[model samples]
Target: MNAKKEPSIWQGFKAFLMRGNVVDLAVAVVIGAAFTNIVNSVVKGLINPLVGAIGTQNLDHYSSCLSSSCKGDQGIHLMWGSVLGATLSFVITAAVVYFLMVLPMAKYLARVEARRKAREGTHEIIEVTELEVLKEIRDALIAQRGSVHDER
Candidate 1:
């Protein structure tokens, strides 16, 4: 029993590992991590400067102090502005991708897929009731019987 159970457990593990989604997700995670560096560089190099020029100009770079000394333990300073800048850049990038790239691609692909499906002449399934199935079978049997009787 234990031997049988171990093989089944191993089979389950193999099946899980072989799933397309699991592999796809692992690749996506790795690629996304690599892509993050590119995103950050674009934010820092180009977007940050442009935004700065238009607005407060590198306001996020500095933090204020309640007192002069930022010595060892006590200071009332916050880098909330940099956090705000990073947040804004992220939001803007997301918006641009959603509006400019993802939205249009999704609509275009959907229409193309619809057209392809139409050309292929595949249709949606309509569920038939049990009565409908019985009626169809009855009609077929009657037609067969009529043919057989006519021959005799």
Candidate 2:
């Protein structure tokens, strides 16, 4: 009787790391980290300055006191400004990734699929026409064979 040995942890780990998705995920993480700097710069350089024209240049500086007679971190403070800045950064990043990367890739893949389907449709039509022609020939051959037998 033969017994199968289970894979060791190291082998399993090696397999996991070698999978295509794991490599793709690693690349995406590195690219995302680099992309984050660009988004932060856009927010700090452009958005913050535009907002600064109306108020403070930094969003982290803006806050609201929830309690009366509060002084110097002695009361409940709502850091809505930081939240707003983070929200803006997230929106900008998502828009850039979608419009610049995801949207174009989706469109390109769709075009490729359409071309493949068109080629397959043409091949199918040819096959069906050929089948019909073969059937017609078969019927004509049977008729000719029947006429020859009648003459006998």
Each candidate's lDDT (Cα)?
0.76, 0.97
What TM-score do all the candidates reach, one by one?
A: 0.54, 0.92
lDDT of 1 by residue, 1-152 (tens): 36544467888999999999999899968976776677777777877787778665564755667778876457877776698777866786677668977899999999999899886664332234556788999999999999999999
Instruction: Give candidate 2 misplaced runs (Cα > 4 Å).
Output: none
| Top candidate, metric lDDT | 2
Residue 84 of model 1 has an lDDT of: 73
Shift in Å, residue 90, candidate 1: 2.2
Q: Model 2 over residues 32-127: C-alpha lDDT tens digits? A: 999999999999999999999999999998899998856888998999999999999999999999999999999999999999999999999999
Cα displacement (angstroms), candidate 2, residue 56, comes to 0.5
